[model samples]
Target: MPAFDIQTARFNMIEQQIRPWNVLDSGVLDLLASVRRDEFVPPEHKALAYADLEIPLPGGQYMLTPRVEARLLQDAAVQKTDSVLEIGTGSGFLTALLARRAARVLSLELSPELVAFAKSNLQKAGITNVDVRQGDGSQGAAAQGPFDVIVLGGSVADVPHKLLDQLKIGGRLAAIVGDDPIMRATIITRTSATDFRTSQPWDCDAPRLQNFAQVSRFTF
Candidate 1:
């Protein structure tokens, strides 16, 4: 294949894919533009870095689409003073984005290989504010409690209450919820110690997160 114009492709991804999807936050747009996504993609898939599709990772997990990633980042409204917890740190692309906006980020991935991959990528990008760990993210990092933001890089049938409890009051969590074929991009804000408000602002499907609580199926 011929050499691709990476700059032009990145610009089009922000303008055509992300911006049109309602990711209008200036800081988020800037971050999206500044982050070199191609560097995080596996060599074989580097050409698809700016494409509107999930790039495959070592594990079965995938990097979220550009629009989905940008939308989640914008919706979470991460601040420089905030601490973030990110689930499913696939290629660490989103982790880098979160680190750019937050004071610190603790990212979890189920696959040990992915953990190492993400760490390497983040380190190469000079992102020091993130700690990538290999573990099941469904339980959330309670020991690191009261994070200002929690983001699930994949979809879940439901956002576990355990994870929500890990949020600081007024903190926000973003996830794609529901089964495949149709899922809602939902954001939950912890209004108080015992109250959380949720809104489904858009629809998208992502690979289901492993180890999350599943609805029991019973038959008579």
Candidate 2:
């Protein structure tokens, strides 16, 4: 069989998969076209790079589907002057995306293996603006923050207040918040020193970020 056409697949992914999902920002589309997603994916799953499925990573974590990633990027509205923080740098794909949009990105991952994996991938992809750190991202990176943007790469039961406090006034955060079968892609904007505005632009599901808070369940 002929080798899978990488360029064709990428074009189809942007038009068929992403555009239909409302990811129409020309800058975002152009960035998607330029970045080679297959390079960030595991070699074993390179063929599925543009597919609308969550590609599994080493530690049972997942790379969010292309549309979800694009939608979150659009929702975040990252500026070139913004300093961004990304929680859960699985594979560094989303981290790379955020890096391209923001001035700099600090992505935290709990798994040391993933941190290494992500760093290698980001380096190979020529994405130098991201700093892949091995740490508990669930708590957010406070010392380097007061960031202009914060993005959670995976779902959380609820958005951590600590993370919200880390944002600069006028900063925005995009996250997948909720439990199984009912998750919403939420965006919270820090409108003022003590005021925030929350909006749910879409609904989607993603593997949970490790070490994040979980909802308590009732016993029968």
Give a tens-digit lDDT track for model 2, residues 163-190: 9999999999999999989999999999
Displacement of the residue 3 alpha carbon in candidate 1, Å: 8.8
Clash pairs, model 1 backbone = none
Candidate 2 CA-lDDT value: 0.92
Worst 10 residues of 1 by lDDT: 1-10
* CA lDDT scores, all candidates in order: 0.93, 0.92
Candidate 1 lDDT? 0.93
Give candidate 2 misplaced runs (Cα > 4 Å). Answer: 1-4, 217-220
- Model 1 stretches with alpha carbons more than 4 Å out: 1-4, 217-220
lDDT of 1 by residue, 93-203 (tens): 999999999999999999999998999999999999999998889989999878999999999988889999999999999999998688999999999999999999999
Q: Considering summed lDDT, which 10 consecutive residues are worst modelled in model 2?
A: 1-10
Q: How far does residue 194 in candidate 2 sit from its true spot (Å)?
A: 1.3
